[model samples]
Target: MKHTKVKDLLKSTTTLQEVNAKGWVRTFRNNQFIALNDGSTLNNIQCVVDFENTPDEILKRITTGAAVSVTGELVESKGAGQTYEIQVKKIEILGDSDPDKFPMQPKKHSLEFLRENAHLRVRTNAFGAIMRVRSVLAFAVHSYFQKKGFVYVNTPVITGADAEGAGEMFQVTSLPMDKLPKNEEGAIDYKKDFFGKHTNLTVSGQLEAETYAMALGQVYTFGPTFRAENSNTSRHLAEFWMIEPEVAFNDLNDNMDLAEDFIQYVIKYTMDKCGDDLKFLEGRLLEEEKSKPQAERSELALLDKLNFVLENNFKRVSYTEAIDILRNSTPNKKKKFNYIINEWGADLQSEHERFLVEKHFKCPVILFDYPANIKAFYMRLNEDGKTVRAMDILFPGIGEIVGGSQREERYDVLVEKMKVLGIDEEELSWYLDTRRFGSAVHSGFGLGFERLVLFVTGMTNIRDVIPFPRTPGNAEF
Candidate 1:
């Protein structure tokens, strides 16, 4: 009658008289033992079928990827891998999958091959574990913010402003491309568009979240953000989720403290809740790394790496100090890095960041007081006229896990900075309003959700963590 999840059934203390378990058949061995998984957990429950009594036709339909419901008695399993097994009394095929056509079989599949079959990839053990850990981490994000009395705000996905000041946003328009309307100067008339102005998908919700933070005192947004960048690197994703938290009356130090605590809290929470999944991923990573040389392998295991972050304080270093460290480092001195760090104002790349975290510091590092010219327009400019009160939290594997800064609260300085950057005063007047009226010092940072998943799950590729990754020239499910 009532179906029990595989995860719950496996943990049962007493044997049940009759239980209904529904899941896709992972494998049917010897026409008697069935490995069934319903995605509730990483492990599958063994379902033993009586092939002598079952019809041959029904047995033939019990193929891999086929959905089936087995009514059976839950008892102690004689199997070695699992503790519980289902003694099936009746078998019903909810959906039949042809063994010849099903893409995922009972065998090892490359991550690349699984990426190609994104829709059906979750049936595999690795993807299933990854998705479970991802779900738990997402919940942990909200739990951390909510428990801290932070108001959850939903910023508009479609906005007229580019929060990051990067022009690589996806344009949202309803106007016909071929029959485009033009102005007197032959420029495309945005007035005829749906929003009556040029609008793009938001790159960050930080600017909008600031408005709420000013009134609400503390606010956070967890939502989808889009970028039109064409890079196909393992770290870059055209579409990804960002978790941004903006707080009022906070400075650079307060922002750093908030970010460090928030990150550690979420990571610890994920580790606590997704213990089984994390263990599975740890083993998966260990197995995967066996193919590589010892020098290239990660020194710490997945769980240990996570616990290390929780146990240690993030080393706080200034941008100037980090630049000095990088400039004198072996890679930069020997011209090994792709981008040399010889100058002060040069933007730090991933290679430089990894060196700081993994090699030099050997722990998470927060580099602050960035050069003003390289940072966004909203960051507070330092009195020295060279740097801004900005910071980036660098992780060992993931370079920059979080980016934030103490916002420019002074209206005059903000206007002057916008004028210098050629940013439209009228276009972002709404954002300027926060500074214009009672703008106290406020700070916020955006954490790339996918990157967090990538780090926690120990998955190398960013595309592997997010479902149905949208990359350049590829949008297949």
Candidate 2:
């Protein structure tokens, strides 16, 4: 608590001017030297100490991940490689860390190894960069929405079912799984679940967002969204953060603009607000590693793309054109498509989406009017008898960062669409009733917060973005 935060260290003339700064040991070397990163700046303040001056007990207590505070003089170094360092006056022991027990160390390790110890991984340079940038991106979201007069609404996480209708929900029941009663069809009776009515975590907050938007005129909900799908992919997490902004008296076009502007704001915000953290990552991969893996290369490319796209405009492409373009492309392009997106009705795969945005548009492109059957039921139908008013903003590396649409404000159309989707109508009375009482044209979209972090920070895995990732077969702390 007595130490300065890592962010407060800005420049040598400013923070380094103190010379006698205190911080924990990120790593050590030469038995007489220590690297102190106060977590205030991207650069760590290197401290050189002779073993004679430093106590054996203090050195014995110290480890790679140990927490220590050093009071030292800022020494300007112009060695063959090194530029700046700190001359130690004395070092104090704030906490002792055992190297064998500490999860992170100076030696190179895989990201998978660190995922097992999330709580401790923040001490690492890469994760520290990611976590700090995540904080910045989240702040950017709130700042952008609030600055535009958008009310931040906290919607209910528990309620009578009726969100995504994915048939995937964790029963919040008091009864033991073995003791719960079953229907004649052998399904567990949800009546035995908590609240007596069926309920689970929400997959999306759009409906609740729309309700708030109707009253507040413009509202946004940023919270946790849960899905029960047992997916093992890097992009799929059972629990993740979602940002949904709803606007009343707006259509799909307005919604797209909002999504584009908001995304640009987040990326630019991270670059501006978290310049130090990103610079740390850039140095680690670019300078230290010589070059990075393909994924990391892709990540850097995206940061460059975001910097340009945020300032420029976005390209708009229709579903029909996207399909035709995919169909017309040559067969052998060494392109790895997750699935075929040719023809109007085929569901767009991640690969196809990446192609359209990265290849065709060459920038962040807004792909609109997706096929009705493939999209959510709330999306407004198109006059072309094929697509819905859904706009997905796809950037170069990450595909489909934003998924949103204009809702069918007309009660009759909404009800019909629900029927077609096999959803019962009576259960959603509160939502449907909104239509009866001045539910004007409204639009909103959900941007996966983790996806935004992955894009901004140049981290590849979604598991690393979330501190405790809940994924298939893996929920380790």
Candidate 3:
């Protein structure tokens, strides 16, 4: 008989006399019951062994992490924890796991310890639930875009230009470090490199996605993005995934509408499809937060928080207005803010954003029209010549989840802005061609894919959401 997934068997309405199940053993209890997981869902199916009829050698091999296949009869479970379980008639050990050697036993493990063993961490209940939610959320992202007639674009992972203008990027080179070639002026010869010029892993796919959007009308890119920043924080990752959507003829207002609606839709879909996983994660979060002070604990439950986002509209405000509120805020007056908002044009930090979302507004906030000096060169300039048509969407727990702006469509304006910022116009002539030929007001935002996963999973650390996290100095397995 064909093997049935544990998820399907668990959801079965009728018990079967003959059924086959194959998975890795999670635990063996009282020499009779075996908990097995197949990565189909967060829940594991319990398999009851007839130990009196079974051999001692087979029972000893049924250790944690051991791969096993069992042919059994599905019956109503007598145990208190599960509704139904398998009555194993025949069992085979595909692989054996030594109890002394297995790192992940049926016990509680710290997140730090789990990070060290990331390759095998998926076997844990928390990690398994997180991965399932991540997969469902990813599908929701694709479904939301494709259903809206948006073309999915695969932008190149390697590019020749610094699209973000912030030059903290990882360089891709093929030349030997010890035996490097030099030019007449003793500079490293980039012509001999793989791309015949300096190139690096892309930090964002927005620029390339824009090219397609100009032609395709609507396009989105979902792919891995890399940065060489050395910050080792819970929120920073050297390599992460980014989801960027570009729409032609979209002004700042249109961009905001798209972002808000898109986020709500995908999150709702995940809530609908992955209800069991979300519930497990929600309980996990509550247990983890028990050590925190009462004041620091979340005011709403996980489901309530997610429902709040869908039920209410995000507060929209201008940068100037946000600055004014921050300047007079209690934190600013009490010197609690690490960097006080003393004047206008000051860049908003993570703390400031959290305050706006958690305390001041009590909801997600979309701040727009930021100072031109603080934003990117490609953002459309406001008539006041001081601020750009930029916006950032701040969430309750995760400060800035989305950032975007209306693109500068005029050739002369874009070129002048690039010149003022000391960017090489010749290097990005192809990008300029969009404005040179035909350009319209366009807008898009990039949502950090891992951050979205982190939010949905109720995971505090960004590293926990990603399977193999790449940080400043850690790249193990």
Name the top TM-score candidate. Answer: 3
Per-residue lDDT tens digits of candidate 2, residues 167-265?
Answer: 376545576865778888998777666677677788888888888888999999999988888778888899889999999999998988888878877
Candidate 3 vs. true structure, TM-score: 0.98
Order the candidates by TM-score, highest first: 3, 1, 2
Which residue pairs show collisions in model 3? none
Task: Report lDDT (Cα) of residue 380, candidate 3.
Answer: 96
- For candidate 1, the 10 contiguous residues with the lowest summed lDDT are 159-168
Clashes of 3: 0
What is the Cα-based lDDT of residue 334 in candidate 1?
Answer: 95
Where does model 3 exceed 4 Å of error? Answer: none
Q: After superposing candidate 1, which stretches have Cα over 4 Å from the reference?
A: none
**Candidate 1 lDDT, 1-477, residue by residue in tens:** 989999999989889669999999999999999899999998899999999999999999999999999998999988797899999999999999999999999999999999999999999999999999899999999999999999999999998877567649999999999899999999999999999999999898888899999999999999999989989999989999999999999999999999999999989898888899999999999999899999789988898889879988999999999999999999899999999988899999999998999899988999999999999999999999989999999998778999999999999999999999898899889999998898899999999999999999999999999989999999886
Clashing pairs in 1: none
Instruction: Assess each prediction's global lDDT (C-alpha) against the native.
Output: 0.93, 0.77, 0.93
